[model samples]
Target: MASVREIKRHIKSVSNIKKITKTMQMVAGAKMQKTLSALLASRPYAQLAWNLLLNLAPKTERELHPLLQIRGIRNSLLVVITSDRGLCGAFNMNVIGEALRQIKDKETHFLITVGKKGRDFFIRRGYKVIAEFTGLGAPAPFISITPISQIIIDEFIKGNVDEVKLVYSDYVSNVIQRPTTIQLLPFQQEQPEEPFLAQFIYEPSPSEVIENLLVRIIEYKIYAAILESQASEFSARMMAMKNATENAENLIQSLILSYNKARQEGITKELTELSTTKAVIESLKK
Candidate 1:
């Protein structure tokens, strides 16, 4: 049992912590709303781009586009996206763990880490990190992620890496964020269920149009993945802070109960001592 003064101090400290966590929860909620809007807005565009790729890819030769050219697995490049800060539960760890599983079987692998957490984690373990990007703002601008995508694109085109993959957290809902791994290169696409009988004429040529669309698709894929990750990070943080605040509140209640019990016991003991002394004095007088 702690002293009354000590218990009071603990209560105050926990109250302060609760205030901080509450503030963080509100901030994360606001950020999550903003990022979620951006994420939702981009989904349609990303899906249409993939559909276009599926429709057009079969009409062209594999060697027609550099991005579509698949090679034997030699060296692989992994782009891992994580949050820069902690206190978000297992958000960063989940993505990092998924990335580790992705590279476990690879003989030659390089990393392009998008956040300080992922970059530091791989660097400390002596993983080959060809590029590192950090300090990406919430609701990250597509332009900021372009350079990161361009690096992997250039590397793949140069035959430095045979395949490129991305590991990130997918935004499922406010309560659930799943670690997801996706291959970005050499542009894998599934066959459409129905064959396209409609023939649309390309403006210049099919190959040239596909070449340009392929780059845009790849860039957009990377951008969309970043958006998804940002949304997930914000969502995870909001829920984590909410939980912390609730836990703090519960702890404060328990501490206050203990403090009152201790104070009541002290007061009762003092009253008992006073009554005992008065009775003794009365007996002596009699």
Candidate 2:
């Protein structure tokens, strides 16, 4: 049994920890709301672009565009996005695991990583980390992704790399984030499953339009992945903090129960001692 002093000290420490976790939960929840809004707003645009590409790219000389052309997946670049700071449970690890599993046996692999966690993990493992960027915001800016996307695009055009794939977490809900991987560059749509594919018309030349569209499409894909990862980060953090807060509350309740039992035991001990002394005094007087 712990002394009351020791127990009190533990309770105080737990209380402080509870405060910190609760504060973090609130902050994460706030950030999650904003991220969710940003991601949701962008979804329509992304979907529309995907649909447009489906409708347009098949009819034109989309093969001329490097981004749209399918190539052998020989020397590939994997872009892995993870959180800079982690208290978000398995969020970062999930992405890292998926990415590592993907490129572990490849003869030659180039990695472009976003976030401190991804860069640190692969670099330590002796992986070839070509470029890394950290300190990206929760809802990362398009400008932040522009350079990263351009580098991959240029590398592909130069035939330095064949295919590029992205690994991140998909934000399903506050309580659920799933590890997701999507191919970025060298995209070949599996033919749109819609009747509207036949009713498409291209302005100017098909080649020119597809050439312009291909760049935008690649940029859009990169942007979408970043947005998804941002939302997932916040969602994971919020969920983790909420769980911590709940666990803290449960512990506090258990501790309070123990504290009450201890106080009752202490009071009972003193009462028993007092009664024994009073009976002895009465017997002496008699």
Candidate 3:
């Protein structure tokens, strides 16, 4: 059994921890709501861009465009997106793991990381980090990522990178986030199940339209992925903080119960000692 003083100290410590965790839970909850809304609002624009590219050009002429040509996946580059801060419940780990799994060591794999966590992880593991960008803790802007995106685009267009893969966590819902990786460059078109695009005629020229649309579509792809990653990070943080608050509450309750028990035992022992001493004095008088 713990002493009364020890139990009291533990109770105070747990109370302090509970206060901190509770505050974090509230902060994460508010930020998660805002980021989630931003991601949702950007979905329509991304879908529109994808649809326009998928419909406006013919598949044959689209292949003639330099960006549409898919070369061998030998020399690949991975763009990893992770949260700048920690305490997000494997939010960064999930995406980092996916990136490691996607990129191989036997080949010449170049990595460009968007967050400090992933950049540090790769550097510690002795992997080559070609580029890195950070300070995007909470509110990440598409404009902030434009320079990085343009660099990757130029590298790919110039035949420096065979393929550009983006590794990030997808925002499934308020409580769910999943690791995902996809080829971001050399855009792939998904044919609809119905024959809707077979009859549509290209405007000026199919190749010209595809060349123009491909550029914007790639940018939109990156913007959408960043938005999804932001939403996922916020959601993970909220869930993690909520769990920490609950665990703190549980610890405080356990410490309180122990404190009461220890104090009761201490009082009982004092009373017993006093009674025994009084009995001994009475015996001596008799």
Best by lDDT: 1
Question: Between 1 and 3, whose lDDT is larger?
Answer: 1
Please, what are the lDDT tens digits per residue for candidate 2 over residues 1-286? 7766667787888888889988887888788788778767877877877777677756766567777777776798999988898998899999999998889554578999998999999999888898999987877766777788789889998888898888988877777888888888787666877868256556787677767766777777777777778778877877788888888888888887788788788999999999999999999999
Q: In candidate 3, where is summed lDDT lowest over 10 consecutive residues?
A: 192-201
Query: What stretches of model 3 exceed 4 Å from their correct place?
Result: 191-212
Provide the global lDDT of candidate 3 against the true structure: 0.81
Report the backbone clash tally of model 1. 0
Please list all clashing residue pairs in model 1, or write none if there are none.
none
**Cα lDDT of model 3 by residue, 155-243, tens digit:** 88889888888998999987889999988876776775345535666677667777777777777777778778888887888888889
Q: For candidate 1, write residues 182-265 as lDDT tens digits.
A: 999998867876688788898798888888888888888888888889888988998899999999999999999999999999
Give Cα-based local distance difference scores for all models: 0.90, 0.81, 0.81
Candidate 2 ranges with C-alpha deviation above 4 Å: 47-63, 104-106, 190-209, 277-286
Model 2, poorest ten-residue lDDT window?
Answer: 193-202
